[model samples]
Target: MGPRFFGYRDRVQDELVREGHQVECVDDRPSETVWFKSLAKISYHFTDRIILHYAEDLAERIAKEDYNMVLYLGGMSFCFTHRQFSLIRKSSNARFVAYLWDAFVNCKRFGQCRDLFDDIYSFEVKDCERYDLKLRPLFYSNTYRSIPLGSEGYFDYDACFIGSVHQYTKFKTVSSIVKELEAQGYRVFKYYFMPSRVAELWCKLTHRCYRGQVFQYESLNTTQVVEVYTRSKAVIDSPQNGQNGLTMRTLETLGARRKLITANEDVMHYDFAQYGDVLVWNSDSDGISGFMRSPYECPPESVLDSYSIKTFVQTLLGEAPPYRGYHNDDCCNETEDAS
Candidate 1:
């Protein structure tokens, strides 16, 4: 699950693998999908019999290894299911943990796997307080950014939405709104589905809806996605209530020195929105879209530059304790009383 799935397992797992851990991933790849081209099509759910076979195989393989920690980075619903977590717990002594993106959005798996985890790792501090169980806070792998262009380029677009067609009403609604926004002279970009290069080439040949005037569907690799972020004036981010709240793109937007107009409620808890830097942008709920003519102005250059990966990673790793760095132009220092 690379650029297709938002906040994928690749870069994060690569970090682990680079750290010299023998990491084996039951990743977003299908059990049988060994080749890259195999991931080009739609998803196929694993049958129970197949899943059990894999589970037993996984259990046996893991049992042989000497791992002290088992981290579930939002892939727990698949890799470490309730049944498998239990099976592994019974057979393995590894500390099982999950890093959930959406602890509250639309929660069904909470009860099933709550006890299975030794700890739930997350970035949103408020969510930890909201949950019934006491969970330890691990700086979620969100303090990273991808700017489409590294240097200055005024390839201006109003906003861009870089995500796939998810099976959620709110997400669909957001897509529609983005299209409407584009229709009104605001350039927007997103994928109809998590598009593959092969599919993209097909669309270009067909002259289908992929080439819509207002909305541009780009199948750029993760690198191009960041360039889109940097080139565009802003990125339209929508936070799914409990699931993966405070969309990672929001942080990325800051990192790219781009503005973010997000309807995500959890983002309000962040200094990004609370401070003058990021806007409390809810087109549907906030009523700001009702009368608000133009989008909130982008923050100054150094404003978001300050919220860079360098500082974010440093702050998260305890290299530098969480210190509120105030920015007068579009930043959280105004919202939070920092001494």
Candidate 2:
């Protein structure tokens, strides 16, 4: 797994260890200095050189080890070149597998490295059909499952939103929703996180929507996110533009047994949404007040279990069948789901 900003890599590794597997965790990008990470977002030349060097080092190390499988999680395009992938493939006899929690649009380089894997999976339905990949949704860690649901009238806030503000559109949409929720007399908790001060300054200079906006620089850990969800009756989700897959937050909300207020209309087609566990909000925040006033309906226990990290790992390792419910053909015309 790549070292993600939210520490999901470590969480996935820990889950593997819990499953009784002797695992070797590799950081695809070990140079995690602030400047190096920031440059990776803007400079393809610099990023490519770093990845190339890392691949050579990794290939040499992999040649010395004997493993049954090489489970790669995300970052195929951003972290590896075709030649680099070939080098690693030549070094190890392990079955190479990849699981892309991100969409193809976000990882444009995925096509170049797609054929190198023995088995590949994606969270987005569109990507699965387009690339002939298996369909799988992102999973919620066990932390969310352990959260005790609050009794009626026990919530500290009516709703909560905790996510990064990556673009101006998401910032504007979230800000408007929060304002509307407050106007309706619902207590709301918001944590709009920006990656760094550098990003904040760049947005301030370029996007008028970000000027004077209050953004938290530090990201909330999984425990903190669970705490916020515990205190809130419902959680808000605004996906990035053109992304059509259920996000980690969406599954986490389900695991926490909380109501979800999302911008993704495609969510209505999911099994969990059939029970009224999710609300698809529009630009004007229509039906939000009534939705928030309604009681949250829990999906079936089987549906919830299918989305746990344990199930996800099992499916990735070919130990269990992939969860099947909604087909991508049913929602081909739909705009997008949450990211």
- lDDT: which candidate is best? 2
Report residue 167 deviation for candidate 1 (angstroms). 5.0
Q: Which candidate has the top score in TM-score?
A: 2
Model 2: per-residue Cα lDDT at residue 65: 88
lDDT of 1: 0.51
Residues 77-192, candidate 1: write the lDDT tens digits.
34334685566666678877655555644334444667877755344444544553322222223233434433224656656777653334445556656766766666676645
Q: Write the per-residue lDDT of candidate 2 for residues 89-181, one digit (tens) a residue.
A: 888998998888778767756568778789887887888767677777888989898988776789999999999996877777788888889
> How far off is residue 96 in model 2, in Å?
0.7
Question: CA lDDT of 229 in candidate 1?
Answer: 64
Global fold similarity of model 2 (TM-score): 0.91
Candidate models: Cα lDDT each:
0.51, 0.80
Give lDDT: candidate 2, residue 195: 82
